[model samples]
Target: MAETEKSGNAFVETIKTIVYALLIAGVFRTIFFQPFWIPSGSMKETLLIGDFLFVNKVAYGYSYASCPSLRLQRFGIDVDAKDICGFFDGDNTRLFGGEPERGDVVVFRHPVSGRDYIKRLVGLPGDRVQMKAGVLNLNGRPVEVEDAGTFEEVMEPQGPQRIRPRCANGAVGDGGMCIKERQIETLPNDVQHTILNIGPQRVDDTGVYTVPEGHYFFIGDNRDNSLDSRVPAAANGVGFVPYENLIGRADRIMFSSAGRSMLFFWTWRGDRFFKAVQ
Candidate 1:
């Protein structure tokens, strides 16, 4: 019996240690650093397929951190509205912290698919956004595009067979999908970086998407390659992102590797360090 009692005590202590460690990690991930992986090429050139990044959790606003832990009043009655359970069990939002700024790289829930997407917020609420001849435009003004020099071969397209190939989801592409490679483009600053561009095969295009209030319109830096707010998602594209759907902000690339090759820490990137987000 004594042996069993000692074993029980050990198990309980182990559980407590684990719980404490998890709590600490969660706190760090929430207030300081959160890790995310690049899933799609939508934000290519800025972020790549295998690139792993860290987001600033406090950059946007508090998620669950904003909630009051306990009622402050001594003799207060419980309010039903404050106690109402939401769609997802624990996640709840009372109010927002900060609004996303122009040129800020952000991660938000997709309006159509309800998935997370990292995009550069080009247009904001009450902004007249227009895309013409590969140039972005604000209210009667061009959104400024500069000619940054060149970058190394970064993103690799699927392959020649993918051209006109039924998209991964079997969405038919305009025969001869597109041939793309590395090229240079002017970033927000005069700093140049290699961006992806497709030749003569834009599958989607639209006109004058007026960003509604409490929402934002986003597009990929790879203009011709991305199926962003321009194309219809019912077919396959991001529409408009509401303010409430925001997750957090993509602040910096913590690390980069050639493949899943994370074993060799030396092989990790040293150049693409703390770059001010685009």
Candidate 2:
């Protein structure tokens, strides 16, 4: 009886410890930073698939989108951020809000689908944004863009989604080289980042988009592949995201793996560990 009691006591203590640890982690994620995993190639060379980073939630202050949305499909758990903090949404306000600067890489909730998307914030409230012949035009001025050779990667399934990359050099077989034209684009704020282009896309030339007040426009680094503000939300694209939907800024990549699973130690990219997001 005594041995059984000791074992039960140990089990109870272990459970208590786990509960406390989980609570602390939850609070940390909610208040300070949120872990974001790059699951797509939209950001391409800048933020590749399987890159893991912690978003600085305090950068833009707290909003409904700041709350973590836990969705474990296998476990049948689907807790949306709106479900946790829906009361704080729809006001277009944030507590201790700070304006996001143009050219900053941000993670925001989609205005219509409520899905999280990471992109470079290119248009602020009331800014006129347009893409003219594969170039970014801001307020009637074309942003400076310089050809920077090419970006190459193996043509194979990427991440867990098994999504293959589009190549400027046409379709290539598995393990073949996939190439995309690379360019260094300089924003009005003087922030420079590398952007990839596969070819001329439908969104390459678009009419001017006037960003609405309390909303922002964003675009992906992979110009041709991104379905960002260039397309309307009703058309399955991420339209102008509201200010309240701003989650945080991704400042650095904590870890990166080139394999399907992070547990595959052999696939880790050592150079990207703790790398700052440019």
Estimate every model's Cα lDDT from 0 to 1. 0.59, 0.94
| Candidate 2 Cα lDDT to native | 0.94
The alpha-carbon deviation from the true structure for residue 221 of candidate 2, after best TM-score superposition, in angstroms, is 0.1
Model 1 has an lDDT value of 0.59
Superposed by TM-score, candidate 2 places the C-alpha of residue 211 at a distance from the truth, in angstroms, of 0.5
What lDDT is reached at residue 53 by model 1? 79
* Candidate 1 off by > 4 Å: 27-32, 63-96, 154-195, 201-205, 264-267, 273-276
Show the colliding residue pairs in model 1.
148-186, 164-177
